[model samples]
Target: MTVPSGIYIRKARIQDVRTIHALLMDCSKQGLLLPRSYNQLYSHLRDFFVLAQDQGAILGCCALSITWDDLAEVRSLAVAPECRGQGWGRRLVEACLSDAITLGIFRIFTLTYQAHFFERLGFQVVSKDNLPQKVWADCLHCPKFPDCDEIAMSIEM
Candidate 1:
């Protein structure tokens, strides 16, 4: 999808992994998002959508990972510091939501500290207990497992 100012969003390609990783790492450092390892990024590259300029710099990235039959998680969202308030983050998320619909998935959720941001996109705050599958499957492995302070937000399409 094309945004104003010569930037566009597209499915991530092999070449964009490093840049995507960097974007996530930067966000992680600021506690905006969780950090992902190179291993995870490479294996799930197809799950990502990247925002890039015409000159080919990756300005932001987000991922949509299928979690169950009708549920998916929107994760690894990050926008470059310079690009944060320009709607690119929303566009990246819309891309993921569109992809979920295309795949016949109707529910999408996110574990995030940015609750207000997701709320602006129509996601409502949800209880972690409502996501048992996610809790058992992935949350168990998270460093902040038992003490996960991230708010759980979800949108039903």
Candidate 2:
């Protein structure tokens, strides 16, 4: 097993599920992001974009879920603490944005507490009410649903 010194970003694969799930849970424990069950991760595994080292150690994971024909939400974005300052997060996000563009998605959104971080990537704050109602359909299952404290932000591709 070897590790890639340069950050390597790629689409999530079946084998990457557990690593991704662990990272998401770590972030979720600190409320940095939402947590996904193994079942859900498997169901939407392809929705994830990940950063892995040469030895295939996953550093972070993020997902882009199409909410409407023109809109997509960046969900479950979590970066490993030790890997936080290296820009792997930005890479993971750009990967998601790139995927959205490739899929003909023009509008991308996220609900996050890291306001400045996402803003640095050109995302702007938006009112949760301004977002489509369909986006809320998943709120029922969210730990912070209805009273979610995360700020809503969006970036145009």
Q: Which candidate number would show the highest lDDT if scored against the true structure?
A: 1
- Work out the TM-score per prediction: 0.96, 0.91
Question: In model 1, what is the error at residue 20, expressed in angstroms?
Answer: 0.9
| Local accuracy of candidate 2 as per-residue lDDT tens digits, 1-157 | 2434666888899999999999889998997877789999999998998887777788888999888889888888888898887777787888889989999999999988899999999999998887865445677777676788889999997
- Residue 6 of model 2, lDDT score: 66
Off-target runs (Cα >4 Å) in candidate 2 are: 1-6
| Candidate 1, 9-74: lDDT as tens digits | 999999999999888898898999889999999999999999988999999999999999989999
Best by TM-score: 1
Task: For model 1, state the Cα shift of residue 46 in Å.
Answer: 0.6
Query: For model 1, what is the C-alpha lDDT against the true structure?
Result: 0.93
Consecutive 10-residue window with the lowest summed lDDT within model 2: 1-10
